[model samples]
Target: MTMDELLHDPEFIELIKQYIDYLKSSVLEINTKLANGEYHDVMKFGHNIKGSGGGYGFMELTDLGKALEIAANDENKEECQKYLDLIEKFVQDKN
Candidate 1:
């Protein structure tokens, strides 16, 4: 189901909006940490997103998060950046 269809209640919709805002802030932090060669933090963020996304009815985000998590685990900066870009795009589109 689409996000709009899943978020039927106005309150829940607002909550989703707030979550998206939180994600936007998180993206900046993740990017900064990634630049500093801190893969652990990025990995943690990806794990968190992976766990939360499906619960929030965003499977695409979950999938991207999984990819990011895997890249971070592998310590592949280039791959991580690619997944991060995809995740950022998803967030931007949703927001």
Candidate 2:
């Protein structure tokens, strides 16, 4: 089903809510990992976001995830922070 229909489907409401919650918590975890200089975990977090965002009909999240992955690979604190901010903002907007 299309994202709009999926989102509006009563049966999918709980699943969507869970996905959003996951995104929220994951953002916090990734931020903490970045702060701790844990590039490996950060990259893994980004990878997870990349893999799952589209399944939840959040394509923008996929792009953000990719950027985050590259940022972690380069150990770019500024870039990581930027993408994290974008992620948090996107989640907030969705809510």
Candidate 3:
């Protein structure tokens, strides 16, 4: 469904915007942590993204985040990168 169809409530849109902003911030933070080899922080950030994305009706993002979380848990960098790429594409498409 289109976002407009999936989200009828204006308040929900506002919440979604907030969640997206948070997602963007978290992406930056997580990327920084990953660059520094702080894998634990990346996992925590992925968990946050999974929860918040689901709460905001961004199911695709939530699924990607969940995958990232799993990869992070396993310290599978390549798998996590795949999920992150999906998320970036999803967000870009939304815009």
Candidate 4:
């Protein structure tokens, strides 16, 4: 289905809601992982979100996820935090 149609569909909307909720809950763990130098886990999480976000019609999330993934891959803590903050803000703005 087209993104517009998926956004209008109740089930798809619910699925998006669930995805956001999962992201919300993961924020803390992600932050903790970052603080601990667990870049691999963070990269994996980012990759998962990057893979799934656009499919759910949240291209912003996909973009942020890509940034996060790249930052994590580089092991750049500051850049990772920046993208993480953007992701959190995006989630807040969406809801």
Q: Which structure among the candidates has the greatest TM-score?
A: 4
Clashing pairs in 3: none
Q: By the lDDT metric, which is better: model 3 or model 4?
A: 4
Candidate 3 ranges beyond 4 A from true positions: 1-6
Q: Give the range where candidate 1 is weakest over 10 consecutive residues by summed lDDT.
A: 1-10
Off by over 4 Å in 1: 1-6
lDDT of 3 by residue, 15-40 (tens): 77777776666676777676676778
lDDT of 4 by residue, 21-52 (tens): 89888977999999999999999989998999
lDDT of each: 0.91, 0.89, 0.75, 0.90
Q: What is residue 7's positional error in candidate 2, in angstroms?
A: 2.1
Q: TM-score, each model? A: 0.91, 0.91, 0.81, 0.94
What is the alpha-carbon lDDT for the whole of candidate 3? 0.75
Candidate 2 wrong stretches, greater than 4 Å: none
Tens digits of per-residue lDDT, candidate 2, 20-46, equal 888899888888889999998888888
The residue pairs in collision within model 1 are: none
Cα distance off (Å), candidate 3, residue 22: 1.4
lDDT string for model 1 (1-95, tens) is: 66777789787788889999999999989999999989999999999999999978999999889999989999999999998888889889996
**What TM-score does model 4 achieve against the real structure?**
0.94
lDDT of 1: 0.91
